[model samples]
Target: MTDSLAIDAAETVDGRDQERGSDFARLSRRIVQAGLLERRHGYYALRLGLVAVCFVGGWAAFFAVGDSWYQLLVAIFLSLVFAQVALVAHDLAHRQVFRSRRSSEIAGLVAGNLSIGMSYGWWMDKHTRHHANPNHEDHDPDVAPDVLIWSVEQAAVSRGLSRFLGPRQAFLFFPLLTLEGFNLHVASFRALSRPSLRNRGLETALLVVHVAAYLAALFAVLSPGKAVVFLLLHQAIFGVYLGCTFAPNHKGMPMLRGAERLDFLRRQVLTSRNVSGGRVVDTVLGGLNYQIEHHLFPSMPMPNLRRAQPIVRAYCEELGIDYLESGLFSSYAQALRHLHEVGAPLRARGSVADPASSK
Candidate 1:
């Protein structure tokens, strides 16, 4: 790795004109030709079947708990099941599971809207833009003008709640993520209600089903206090589970200025970080542990990411580009450190400046 670093530095200084982007394209072609793009139908079937069991079993357990304090425990379990279902929806939106785009869309709607009360169309629009331009403050919805600032420019413009939270964001990051489940559901409903959005009726109907069924189940099985507690536990854990999985993928990595024109390969690899873990972590993150590979090949099947890791890593090493991989705990630490660093300007200046002026 040290030797490769030296080579990378030399290439940067010498202004190499070797068309490195083409090399990336060639490697991508090789990966496809090697059948890494092929769907593993049996694997997906098994995984989705297990997810179905969890969802059904979780709800069954909740109903069975019936006024018992143990319903809290059941609620936590249900949150995990919902998180797994969301992961499946993510894969479906990426078109990684089915050959037919229509099949993937249908699955995404069922898992996201009907099951999780999130709009598939809303998520798809945001996520597709994110993939196309990760970490860009302007183009990437994931990083765009959020309360948690990722760049000094964003911090400089912080106001209201964001202003109050700017200096304390690192400490608040995980706590804030606990609310993301509610935030996402609200965002989905808002998106579906937009007059310009197509198929709003379908998305709205699915979300209505999810909300009605979810509330009905809780009211049927538990007292008012227990129901409130159950909702809190379920949504909080669901949010944290999602945040823990996704925050590490790009939070501590490079932030792209919207103006820069980067090749597909450089853009993806540079902005993404891979999490290092075994089977349990992989299962929880749904192969998002291999974020670098997933970003490079967004449509690739999840089961194939582990197989492609070595190939991608070696190629990156040969190209002398950095390929970051860290344990789960370390990744979170890195993200927090970054959040702290970006917020420094806000702390030091003690005033919000115009973001345009920062530019």
Candidate 2:
């Protein structure tokens, strides 16, 4: 009798979850209209404008300002604008927010190369793999043998270099993992057949020109020291935005066995979470803070993010899936703490099979 009752309770819970998922599915259909017809177009257009302004205005600010904190402000402006551009590039590469492949690829290259050196084909491959198998222990490229979640067997396996690097591996591993730019460059320059020949060569040329332009702008505007300051300051601050914004989309969240058990609605709620932001921040961040919706419906624009939540919440409730949402600072803090909890390979190396490796 008890066993039968337990099964019933579980089924009831799952039923409710499915109902909510169905609701999100319905909401998704209503929302994901084609093209840049909605506010999303406007929002992206505005962000693109801001990126242009920052590029032009940053230089103006550098020339205008003397030795003071004003330069820092300009740097922040450059970084923030450039970060949005990078996110757009990210979205384009993902095919999340664009209508056509050519347009997305073009946007991705223009933004990515200027903002961060990225190769189109290379980024596409790695990112596709990441989304395809987010948290699988073995198959997911994102999960190195070292980047374990929580399993005794997994921990035991984390011996040697994995054990040694377990604590700060993600940080150190970033440079190698995100080397698409270098990868593309080499593939274009080195490969005999040159598979990505035209695309890679064009981007490589653009990148060379971009560097040269920056150098010319540097000498024209200010001294060598100031130019270095400009690049370093913007790049580092942009790093902060990149690290936090991108990490939250998946890292602390539970991984899936596969997308099998996932419905469209559950996929978003279960696999993703949201961080509340003001209109300015929301717009600037590319609606990424409302990450759940963004992940579920990449075509939905940033302008609609504010309006999309209430509808999405309704669906989540019916399905019984948790719709994680919180203020930005709170989420950031939570992610940080979760980092150590998730990260504690406590010993010189926590045993892969050892539960004691983490609480």
Candidate 3:
């Protein structure tokens, strides 16, 4: 099934490229000349300012709660703030918020490492590869071996715990994401510990400060029980929030095998899905609802994604390429369904195995 799907997708791409080989590059240049690539300073200032105010407000509330059960509420608010700040860090990593690479790096470090206890260098290295090859089995870190088996090929190779979990992954996906916040912090620390990583000392120091300050503030303001609960709530919600925003982008989209070659536009569009919603959804998602547009132009500012959507969609339609967009709920459902489908064969095989063989 996986091989057949790969062949069909590859054939579609080859056919499309023959008809519209240079259209993507030409359209990209036109979009650039039309100022879609320009930064919106005012928009970014408003967003950054709002994030800062919410972050400070959340911390202030945490201190004021003072041993009350309201500390839990404050923790939830803090998670939202952290998610928003992380989105800003995402934009900075893409160099979408600033023209100067150094300025963007500074902003990313401050938001990712200092504020959110993640390593910016680590995230940038992984995310750049993801953007370049959105859903490539070998190249995209987002779909690499993790708690989820994104492709049937991956499911086929599963063993031990992964094999046990593979058949049930769709059912367990969201619950597993509750651990993602914790997982990301661990990954960041591990990345920083690599001997080959540059500026490792500074990244380590920033992570330490974030951890110490985050813990001290909770311990200082809440009872021991409340503090423990608060930490769990904060991290779990943070994980879910992050997963919700990102899972809709590429989870159900086409997966590229390592051997397939595709043109720039075909690769981006085919491997990306967009969520259809209004401003509230857009703001919550940090404009990531426009995943198709963002994947095509990674460095386009967040605000510009909405504007680029119609043009990109029309272009894809004219070229007879698939342009996928769905409501938030529908997108998630599709992703879950895709996971279930991928695991179906493994699940059937597992079901037929002898009970004595398990031992």
Candidate 4:
């Protein structure tokens, strides 16, 4: 394995690299020939229609149920519905549903800011950086040390909540994710202060309207106590659902160290792990189960990703690059194991676990 990696590194040197500039070009040609790059307008239309029906139906049910505990069930249903809306917003952000940026952003604002109360502009900037460098410790915001440490170096310097959670993070990961929805809301509101965010006025207005309308609906129908419970439960379920959907994509994959570079194909392929499943998994994850394919072709329509998978896998195999895929549960286990390993040292010392000690 070490020798193969050494050979891979050597092949990447001096611009003579077989897979540097030309490899992705070739793969892209194959993908285009397969017609996988074409937009799936019909698919998006059907999907958006179903999503709208669910969204409207969920709210209608919420009103019909009134101030009862049964509303919690409605909350669960709506959380799932909201997640689907966010997925549509994700496709819009990637331009998978629209050819023009203006069209995509207009749809994105409605799906994100108005429908979901997430700031599309803020998420786009962050998501773009993540796609540019999927698992780079320095560059990918998704992998950066925060409430949970992703690397030994990060574990060593861990402070505050991260330090407290490091040793037990794997166990607590899902529980912590219950707060992810709330965190996203806070981050969206906070990002309005950043001067780099475009359409600041429009973004703020949409978000404010969403919050005001959502709160008013809850309080007007349910008692204050039930409304608060409904709000917290809905957001918590949404957070957990979103986190679970994304965590399996790159969490346990190889992390690119400082200044380590690869051609675009290897950069994305080596750092992503796909979850193998059928249509149900595809729907649940919004096509993110095909993480490798999606990373390789960010603009590819979600429905087209499955068709592109075999072509991509065969090409990677031909080039002697690893293409990782695992069963859905196996992927989660790998991610949790990685979390456990990263905190091994702190667990031993009764301080923060040292990510290196597990090695």
Candidate 5:
């Protein structure tokens, strides 16, 4: 293994100007063409089973415990499962989770829309734009304007509020910013619902299906208030899971773009960093700690992330790429203070046009 990695490393050094992206493309084609994409059927079964146990199990726990305290616990568990659902749905979007296109499409509708309140077209389109221009100041759709940054007037108003309510807000606010519908999807959903929409009918139908399913489940099980509580608890879990996580990657730092042509791809790889305290945190975070890998190899399955880590690092390191990284808690802690950090004039003054700028 070491010998092979050494050769790959040497190849990376000489292949700097050799257009090895195409080489890797051809190489991958050969490998996958040799009966790799034709997957056995068992992976789909396991995926279905896990999805069922996670989503259904959360609702079951809510009724099974019947305690107010347990509601929060079930919500937390469900939130984790939902995070997994996001990751899995992402896998489905890229055609990694399910081998069959039909299976992938159907599963994506269920997991993406019904499970997560995201229409497949809406989420996939944004994700596609994200990959096309990650961290690009001009193009990457995911590089949306942040609400964290405050103008001078706003900062003045927030000074007292931040001190008095910052910690409390941190406790509850992290979940609010990153969940599917609340913060992340607000802009996205609005765009999807526009009159000039591309797939408005299909996407709206999916959105309706998800809302109707949630409402039906709520009405069938308990009173309306309890159903609302269930929904709130559910959103809260995902909020924290996504809020802390999604924030860490791009908040504290500036979005950088590379040269022309490879502009966004370079920004993504150079600007993204991997957090590594250990395997425990990495697994829980769905290997999102490996953010650079996730960005560069978006189609790669989440589980194959750790496997590709060393290769990705070696290649980028040889190319003088800037890979931002910190420990598990430190990255998130930095994220917690991101709005403040970026709010500072010193940090905010310089535009993030270059991918090399780091605080």
Candidate 6:
């Protein structure tokens, strides 16, 4: 699956397999000439070292705090650390840090399965589809009919919990994300039974180690009640943090429908959004704030995404494309507004139905 994804990524270069005068081919030439796709081993080495220290130090503090309620503070800190670790895993899966598949997968396994208890294979497969067709309702799992519906068409046919949640999802979005961490763990374990997942034995072993160690550490240091609370708090924070980091990238951007064919440049630029921010925002969002550039060149180094922004934006303007970049809070607002609009039909239906039947 990683190899396949790499193949998909490679097709972006000089717009291979594309016709002459391809817009993406021209853009690719500029990006290549600007040296945006080069590997950044030094930056990654320092980054990985710092993250390793923080991860280990956070746990050391957790044990040091012993049975104190102050351990809750440690839980919050660790959850933030875990999100950062997951971001590292994201880069690894993109092969941004490592040029070789073997090296990337090895580090991805450590960062994803062992450290975070999420399946690298599972996430890679899903993310690969997302990149291949960003914001396509039919193809992008991110916008598929899940607990929250992303389109009115999906909402119109929603049933069971999805139906119940659809109308209020905008209001409930953040609260629901509190469980996203747990959902990821459950999804990872469940996906292990699938026949297509690579390295099944090793992935399972790493995941089991992560789960066992995580639970044992909590219970060994604190009472059962306190341990449970710490676990919940940690997972909740992790979920919300992770959700926030990703939600701004494409939530309110254009949605591609079935049979809608677009050139590579338009498909990526039109459906993706950029969040306007500086270095701190870049770090917090894991450089995903530059969504347009990242989707265009998935394997581009994170720091280089920042530098490539101006060139990409100018090129989009030259082509008369509506490049969307929004302030952080405005982006969230736009996403929530889109969610609300998606559920308008459900809201109207409920309002006109018999009151008792509605309950």
Which candidate gets the maximum lDDT versus the true structure? 6
**Using Cα atoms with residue i matched to residue i, what is each candidate's TM-score against the true structure?**
0.91, 0.71, 0.92, 0.92, 0.71, 0.96
Tens digits of lDDT, candidate 6, 244-288: 999998998888888997887888899988998799999999999
lDDT of 5 by residue, 251-338 (tens): 4555544454553235566667678867777656766787876665555555666666776566557667666778867776765565
Q: What is the model-wide C-alpha lDDT for candidate 2?
A: 0.58
Compared with the true structure, model 4 gives a TM-score of 0.92
RMSD values, in order shown: 7.7, 9.6, 6.1, 6.6, 9.1, 1.8
lDDT of 1: 0.83
lDDT of 4 by residue, 62-132 (tens): 99999899999999999999999999999888888987778988999999999989999999888988887
Compared to the true structure, candidate 5 yields what TM-score?
0.71
- Local distance difference test values of all predictions, in order: 0.83, 0.58, 0.84, 0.88, 0.59, 0.90
Candidate 5 overall lDDT versus native: 0.59
Q: Please list the residue runs of candidate 2 whose C-alpha ends up more than 4 Å from where it truly belongs after superposition.
A: 1-27, 32-39, 63-73, 94-98, 137-156, 159-162, 168-198, 219-229, 257-264, 348-359
Please, what are the lDDT tens digits per residue for candidate 3 over residues 1-359?
01110111123334544543577766675567667878899999998999999998888877876899978888889999999999999888777788777788788888999999989888877787787788998988899857678888988887777677889889999998899899989999999867765568888999999999999988887888999999999999999999999999999889998789788789989999999989999999999999988877777888888888888988888899999999999999999999899989789887788565887
Write model 2 residue lDDT over 171-212, tens digit each, in one string: 453443333323434543343234643476776766666667
Error of 3 at 285 (Å): 0.5
Report model 3's TM-score to 2 decimal places.
0.92
Prediction-by-prediction clash tally: 0, 11, 0, 5, 2, 0
Cα lDDT, model 4, residue 190: 100
lDDT score of residue 216 within candidate 6 = 95
Candidate 2 versus truth, CA RMSD in Å, comes to 9.6
Model 4 residue 227 distance off true place after TM-score fit, in angstroms: 0.9
